[model samples]
Target: MKSIGSKWMVVLFVAVGVFMLFNGRAQAAYPEKPITLMVPFEAGGGVDGFARALASRMEKDLGVPVVVSNEKGSGGRRGSIALFKSAPDGYTIGFPHIATLIYDDTLGETKSPVDYSKYAVILRVDTATFFMYVDKKQPFKSVKDMKSAGQALKFASTGIGTPSWLIPSAVGSAAGFRTSFVSGHKNLAEAALAVARGDVVGGTGSYTHFRGVIDDVRPLVYMSDKKSYHLPDVPTIADLGFGKLSTLGVPWVIVGPPGTPEDKLEKLRGVLRKIIQQDEFKKWGLENGYEPDIMPPDVFWKKMGELKEVYLGLKPQMQEKK
Candidate 1:
């Protein structure tokens, strides 16, 4: 009887040990299900492509499927709102620009459930300086010619509060010209297409959007202190004498909903850090006009804060144009 009782106790001990081991493994498994990546733009555009590429690479490292969902509207507001309002289970994340995330919220134009401050930015994939593209059919030969034309010109913008409109408006204010905006284009490609088709006199967006139509449109000036590597001949807005706004560059961030677990966030950051370091991702970035610099969470948030302040100072000017 004593030997039988001892055998029963040993069996119970083994069962408890097995249960503990499985529980530990379960707890460590961060992404037990597929992850959804939210892109706040139309499919087949630059941002969507970036999301798809990033998702593909992340899937390998995470051991789970990464899906890209396009939540197009309000120049990234719709997707960002959805991301922030999602369950904090580390499943849904968003890729949104800081400017668009804060645009409507800052201006009080409409009620927003998610403020830019609420985002837990995990990584910064790239940055783009604004560039102005003119219709190839237009008589303007260069930035000089465009400035010399001295006529109120139409510029295509994604919407009222988008960087597509804000950058051009700011440049117009600083450079002493009048700009009439053709707002409500869905994406940067649409804005570029409008310029290419002569639907608008010109348009403003990052190079990624304009690169495809480089032959169809003339890149006059980029809002950078130095000439872009891709557009070596084109002068910068600073060189064109609007040096004040030359520092503006839109950063693309990967943000998770607030209250995401720190461990999960770290896991994401680790995977992205590895992904961006690969030669394939680097080559892809160069080809796609994406700057292959990975700003980690701490640095990204700090840069975002500075950018927010700069935009806040520039917001009043943007709003007056409305």
Candidate 2:
């Protein structure tokens, strides 16, 4: 009953409506599908355990399964690459420590696919607090005793470029002592075990990773300038005259691949904020030696940039060793 012109207008309006409807459906709230959390460590490790626990809690909040995928290799480089290569749809995220993210590239170990800028850092859950520990039954109790031995102490290392290696190397260099690393352990737990079995003189890593084996090791010194809240009686590396070499603890950040939608990022951030707030999470963190210190995206990324500069300064020294 309408004129040809009016009919065409009606058809155009309907077409636009249909297009918009489909577009709306396409852009529907993020995480319509299950999200994947890529943990760059073995199943039994602390990072893996934390990822699984967080995924379980996130699933409750998201109403969608938050699956944990262990893509362990290259001292976490493999998992980080997998995370970098994943589509930027907010479906895949990575839980790699700050050190691993920059280590490979900084040391020229390998070319990483991740564009550090493209990574949308979601949260910084905690900082890695390392302690220098020796076997409880070892003959030497103090650094002076080890120094007086007049030989290079055999230290258990996770691998080259990890905190396990860097911390000890830095301390030994600063303290004017000699150390030789025996690399091959998968994680700090294994390294600590090696120390216990007399395979190595000492081991260094996060206190959380060493908690299970603390009974078998004597913590010689904390790596931070200040004493750890958990190990109040322990002396800091600074107090022992190696303060100049001590780097701030490495940050543990959760990051999404490039081009992740801002809204989606915020949604996940909110969920994580709530997750960290849960009493159960807080209790577990304390038990595991993880300090609950969550930071927003801006602050987290800013700190990451600052830490990168610190690593850059250390690169010349690292290269000299190579």
Candidate 3:
């Protein structure tokens, strides 16, 4: 019996060693297969466009197909949950709205499936200032008009967890107006379309998806510490005296599932760093409303932590009835 047990142990040890050796090589040769970049929104939405553009650039550098998969639902949490729960292999990376997810998971009354902090933070890819846009046909031309209208204006958002909901809700409360959010649009483009078609009074998002409908929907308020370069005449939320509702616009970050191999993560990060430094990539982001803000993994995660603290400070307001 002792001899048989010894033989079995030796075989087991050899098997384990072989597995580890192959795994290390797999990590070293990351992207041996096509990488799947899971974007948690509909295809035509802001996140999807950004992901596809990023994938194109990544493919050029990585020399492998970078396919974008849209996993739309729960205002982003659905696809995000899929991403975080996926295997920690380098091939299954994704773009998760870590900042908004932080707001949803921590201060929100209803919890989300994503743990916000569970994923591997690759880097902060882009940031855009939130803007409130309303259809031109709407009677209100400005925030002041909407405030004094004395009726609750209907608004739409991709999900309750997104800035489209939070910004409108907070801004309405602080500015002394009654407003209600229409949720379940899947993404900002749909919400913007709802605003254009008069399905809702307005919506808020960084990318308004106003290409052909620029004249149709007009921006009412910008939610940033400063005015946007394009909308220099518009007023920020702070400028309108809602300093308490201060918010850094939405951030889209690239991430991997929890426990992704360190070597694979580093390899991916190096490729991204090269892409981010490219002039063409930076130009593309600027033109697409994707403010190219680059940060290392540690710095980006630290900033996310700080953002969570800021959101926590706004918990009282977030819980208030809109």
CA lDDT, every prediction? 0.81, 0.79, 0.78
lDDT of 3 by residue, 171-208 (tens): 77677787788888766776778888989889887753
Task: Point out where model 2 deviates above 4 Å.
Answer: 1-26, 109-113, 143-145, 241-248, 319-322
What does candidate 1's lDDT look like per residue over 1-322, in tens digits?
A: 9999999999999999999999889869989999999988889878788889999999998999999999988777878778888888889987865676665666536756667777887888777777887899998776656566567778998887778877777777666666888888888888898899899889887788888788899888888888886777888987888776775677778889888887788889899999999998899888888767888878877776776666677767777777
Q: Against the hidden reference, what TM-scores do the models get?
A: 0.88, 0.88, 0.85
lDDT of 2 by residue, 1-322 (tens): 4698899999999999999999887776567899999988888887877778788999998989998999988777778778877898989997865576676667657756676667878887767778888888888777656767578778898777877877766666666677778987887888888988878889987777778888898888887788887888888988998665455466777888878888788889899999998888989888877767788878877766665776677776666544
Model 3, residue 179: C-alpha shift (Å): 0.8
User: What TM-score, to 2 decimals, does candidate 1 have?
Assistant: 0.88
Ranking by TM-score: 2, 1, 3
Is candidate 2 or 3 superior in TM-score? 2
RMSD of 2: 2.7
Identify the leading candidate in terms of lDDT.
Answer: 1
Q: Alpha carbon lDDT of residue 176, candidate 1?
A: 60
